[model samples]
Target: MGKKEKSYALGVDVGGSHITVGVVDLVSRTIDQKRLERHPVDSKGSLTEILEAWAGAIEPFCQHEVLSTVQIGIAMPGPFDYDAGISFIDSTQDKYESLYRKNVKDLLAKKLGVSNAQVRFKNDAACFLQGEVFAGIAKGYKRAIGMTLGTGAGTAYYHGTEAHDAARWGEEYGDSIAEEYFSTRWFAKKYQEATGKELSGVRELVDMKEESWVQAIFKEFGQNLGKFLVKFASEENAEIIVLGGSIAHSSALFLPETEQVLSRSLPGVPIKKSILGEESALIGAASCWYEA
Candidate 1:
C-alpha cells in the first residue's frame, strides 16, 4: 500500500496592524514553523491596496508545490459576517475602513487564483480560543474560556470542537464595556494619573517595576481582570480560562492579583497563560477545516 498523503491548510490571521500566514497540519493540529510568514498591512490603505497586500502575503503558500492542495482558513477581526465572508468594519476606525462591506473571501480567492468555496473564515477571538483548546493550554478542558488582552480585550468560550464569544450580560464597568477597563489604554491612563508622566504602553509600565506606581497599576489591573473573569465564569460556567496576546507577557506582574480576586468567589477554576503565544490563532484557523 502507498503512504497516506499529508493534508495541510493555510492559516491566516488578519489583525489591525499585521497579517500572518502559515501552513498547518490538519491532523496534527500543528503549524509548519518554517513556512510561517508575516507582512505589515497599511490599515488605512484603499480597498484594492489592502486586498492586494493580503493576497500577496498569502500567494506564496498557495503556489508552493508541496502545499498546492492546501485549503485556506482566515481568522478575521469582526464585526463581520463569517458565513458570508463580508466585512462590516466602519470608517470610524482607521484600519480596514476601505474593506467595509467587501466580500473578502471572494476577493482573496480570486487573487490567489482559487475558488471562493475553498476558503473559510472565523472570528479572530473564536480562533484564538479554539486554537488553545485544540492544542494549547486548554486542550483537555470541557468548558474553557480565553482572553487576548492588547489594544482591546478579546474573549471567547469553548466547548467540544468549537469556540464562541461570551454573550453580553448587561454588566458594565465605569459605564463602558468590559474591554474598556481590561485593555492597554486602561493601564496607560492609570499610569499617567499616578506618576503625572506619559508612558507608551503596558510594556513600559512593566519595565519600571521598581516604581511604586507601576506596581500599583498592575495590581489594580489584576483585580479588574479578576472581576471580569468572575463575570464570565458565572455566566459561562467555564472550567478553565486561558490568557493570550502581547500583554500576557507581563503575567508575573498581574497574575497574582488576578488570582487573588478569583479566589474570593471561585477558587476551583484554573487560570492559565497561553503557551502557543502568537501561533494560537494560526493553528486555530487551520482547525476550522480539520475539525469541521
Candidate 2:
C-alpha cells in the first residue's frame, strides 16, 4: 500500500502590526515551520494597502501545488463578523480602522484568485486558545481561559470541544475597562506616571527588574490580574489558565504574585504559559479546516 498523503491547510494570523502565514498538517495539528511567512503591516494604511499586505503573505502558500486546493483559515481581530467575513473595526481602535464594514473575505478571495468559500475567519483571541486547547498546554483540560497580554489584551474561553472569544476586553474594571488595565499601554502608563519617564513596553520594564519601583509595578500588576481572573475564572468555571503573547514572556516577574492572589480563592487552578508561542494561533486557525 502507498503511504497516506498528509492533509494540509493554510493558516494566517493577523496582528496589529504584522501578518503570519503557515501550512498546517491537519493530522499532527502542527505548522510546517519551514514554510512560514511573516510580513509587517501598517494597520493605519489605506484599505487597499492593508488587504494587499495580508494577501501577499498568504499568496505564496496558495500557489504551492500541494496547497493550492487547501482552505485558508484566518485568525482575525474583532469587531468582525466572522461568519459573514465582514469587518466592523472602527477608528476608535488604533488598528485596522480602514477595514470598517468591509467584506474582507470577498476582498481577500479576489486578491488571492480564489472563491470566498475557500476562506474562513475566527476571532484571533479564540484562535489562540483553540490552538492551545487543540494541541498545546490546555489539551487535556475541559474548561480553560486563554489570555494574550500584549499591545492589547486578548481573552478566549475553551469549553472542551471548542473555543470562542470571551470578548471581555471592554468589560468594566478599575478606573477603566479590562484592556486599559491589562495591556502594554497600561504598563507604560503606570511607569510614566511613577517616574516621569517613557517606557517602550514590557521588555524595557523587565530590564529594570532590580529597581524597587519596577518590582512594585510587577507585583501590583500581578495582584490586579489575579483579582480579575478570580472573577472571570469563577464565572467560566475555568479548570486551567494559559497565558501567552509578549507580556507573558515576563510572567516570572508577576506570576508569583498572581499565584499568591489566586491561592486565596481559585487555588489549585493551574496557570501555564504557552508552549507553542506564536504557532498556537497558526495551528488553531488551520484547525478550523481539520474536519473539512
Candidate 3:
C-alpha cells in the first residue's frame, strides 16, 4: 500500500501583540516546526487590520491541496465567547479593543475563503494546559493544573479527558488579585519598590540574578506562588502542576523556593516547566478538532 495519508489541522495562538500559527499532525499530536509562522499584530489597530494579519498567517497552509479543507483551531485570550466565536476583549484590557463583541470566527473565515464552521476557539490558558496534558509534561497524570506566567497570569485545570479555563486570574490573594502576585508585573513592581529603579521584566531580573536583592525577590515570588498553588491545587486535587509562559522560562530562579513551599503542604505533587513552550498552545489548539 502507498504510505498512509497524514491528517493535519491549523493551530493558531493569538497573543497580545502577535500571532503564531503552525500545522499540527493529528496522529502524532505534534506541530510541524518547519511550517510554523509568527506575525506581529497591532492589537490597537482597526478591526480590519487585525483580521487581515491573522488571516494572512493562516492562508499559506490552506494553499496546499492536502490542507485545503484543514480545520482551524485558535487559542485566544479571554473574555471571549468561545462557543459562539465572538470576541469580548474591550478597551479595559489595552489590547484588541477594536474586537469588542466582534465575530472573529466569521470575519477570519471570510478573509481566508473558508466556512465559519471550519474555525474554532479555546481559551489560551486552557489550551496551554490541554497541550501539556495531551502530549507534554502532564501526559500521564489524571488531574493537572497548568499556569502561564507572563505580562499576566493564566490558569487551567485538566480533568483526565480534557482541560478548561480555571479563570482564577481575578481570585483574591493578599492585597490584590492572583494576577498581580503571580505575573511578570509583580517582579517589576517589587524590584522598582526595592531599588528605586525600573526594570523591564523577568529577563532583566534573570541577568541580575547575582544581586542579593534579585535573589530575594525570586524567592519571595516563589513563596507567594507556592502559597497560591496550595489552595488552587488542593481545590482541584491536581495530581501534577505544569507551568509555561515567559516567566516560566526563568524557572530556575524561583522554582526551588516554589518547590520548598509546596513540599510543606502539597508534597509529592510535581511541578514541571513546559517542554513545548510556544508550541504547546499550537498543538493544544489543533487538538480541539482532533479530539472532537
- Supply every candidate's count of residue pairs whose N, Cα or C atoms clash at under 3 angstroms: 0, 0, 0
TM-score computed on alpha carbons, candidate 1: 0.94
Candidate 2 whole-model C-alpha lDDT, 0 to 1: 0.90
Q: Give the runs in model 1 whose Cα sits over 4 Å from its true position.
A: 1-6, 65-68, 167-171
Return the clash pairs for model 1, or none: none
What lDDT is obtained when candidate 3 is compared to the true structure?
Answer: 0.90
Using lDDT as the yardstick, the better of models 1 and 3 is 3
Write candidate 3's Cα lDDT for 1-292 as tens digits: 1244336788899999999999898778888878999999999999999998998888988887444466888999999999899999989889998999999899988899888988999999999998888779988899999999998899999987878999999999999999999987898799889988887778988998999988999999999999999899999999999999999988999999999989999998989999999999988998887743
Q: Global lDDT of each model?
A: 0.84, 0.90, 0.90
Across 93-179, the per-residue lDDT of candidate 1 in tens digits comes to 568988899898888888888888778999888889988988888988899888888887788998776998653322587578777
Candidate 2 Cα outliers beyond 4 Å, as residue runs: 1-6, 66-68
Cα displacement (Å) at residue 120, model 2: 0.7
Give the per-residue lDDT digits (tens) of candidate 2, residues 45-154.
Answer: 99999999998898888878543465899999999999999999999888999999999999999999888988999999999999998889998899999889998899
Q: Model 3: runs farther than 4 Å from truth?
A: 1-6, 66-68
Lowest lDDT block of 10, candidate 1: 165-174
